[model samples]
Target: MSTVLQLVKRFREVLLDGVWIANTNFKDQLKDVTWKQAVIKAGSLNTIALLTFHIDYYIAGLIRVFEGGDLEIRDRYSFDLPPVESQEQWESLVNKLMSDAERFAVLLEQMPDTKMNEPFVAEKYGTYLRNIDGMIEHWYYHLGQITLIKKLLSSDLI
Candidate 1:
């Protein structure tokens, strides 16, 4: 398989299926999680819903970039998920995340392997491969937080 395709597969594995190291994915971690559970605050940390939103927000911006659109997402606003008070809102957010993840993988798969070595945005920013891999790393980092927070919230000690 091509490098881009391989990367896309890795992305899918980490997000929706098990990967080599973690043996768990975002979808697995969120299994059976109700909307109520998603909004629960495990201590002072971010809610699961907020972290899900944050993960997708960056991918949304990266999709725009790969589509030849401008990247307008800001770090501060990335975590600014509105209150998911109702089940509908929570479901909507999750659905959006799933859709965005699929789209991102497709976009990456479509990218030529040669283009992976090109600068992503500017010389200082880094190459397409670097940014794409970094995105996966970012997702994994936040995935860890989400998993830990979920466990904390579900435990009796919480």
Candidate 2:
């Protein structure tokens, strides 16, 4: 495979693997705690559930933008975070996230290698590759936050 294709494959693997493991770890920790406990304020902002939604939100938005679609997250603070009231709600969001990621993954894989290095203009970010590089960094950063939050939430359970 070409370098871009290989990079795309590696990117897909990173996304899928991180989501799979993080979701599993979070859900497992969540099982022993009530919604209130899960949403307990560990700090000023971002509950475990909110962090999870934030994770999916950015990944989906970035992938959509990379696919030459209109920007998804126009206003960073425009959206409300998901409420951690029930496991069912959390599970629903998680499922939607997985579905979104899978769709984006397929789209990325179908893209021509030449497209990866091509320039696309964005209002906020000038070039496409720059945005994609930022996307990868952003996703992994949130993955770290999710892992930390899961551990914090897991404390009460254990």
| Residue 150 Cα positional deviation in candidate 2, in Å, after optimal superposition | 1.8
The lDDT values for all models are 0.87, 0.61
- TM-score leader: 1
- Tens-place lDDT per residue, model 2, 1-158, is 86455555555544655354334333334345455655677766467567667767766776777677776575474246745677677667667666776776677677676766666554456555566666666666665665676677668743
Q: Ten-residue segment with the worst summed lDDT in candidate 2? A: 21-30
lDDT of 1 by residue, 40-157 (tens): 9877899999999999899899999989998788899999998999888888888888889999888888889999999988889799999889989888888889878877876896
lDDT, residue 153, candidate 2? 67
Q: Count the backbone clashes (under 3 Å) in each candidate.
A: 0, 0
Residue 58 error for model 1, in Å?
0.5
The per-residue C-alpha lDDT of model 1 at residue 129 equals 92
How high is each candidate's TM-score? 0.94, 0.72
Candidate 1 ranges with C-alpha deviation above 4 Å: none
Q: Model 2 lDDT vs. the true structure?
A: 0.61
User: Using alpha carbons, what is the TM-score of model 1?
Assistant: 0.94
In candidate 1, list every pair of residues with a backbone clash. none
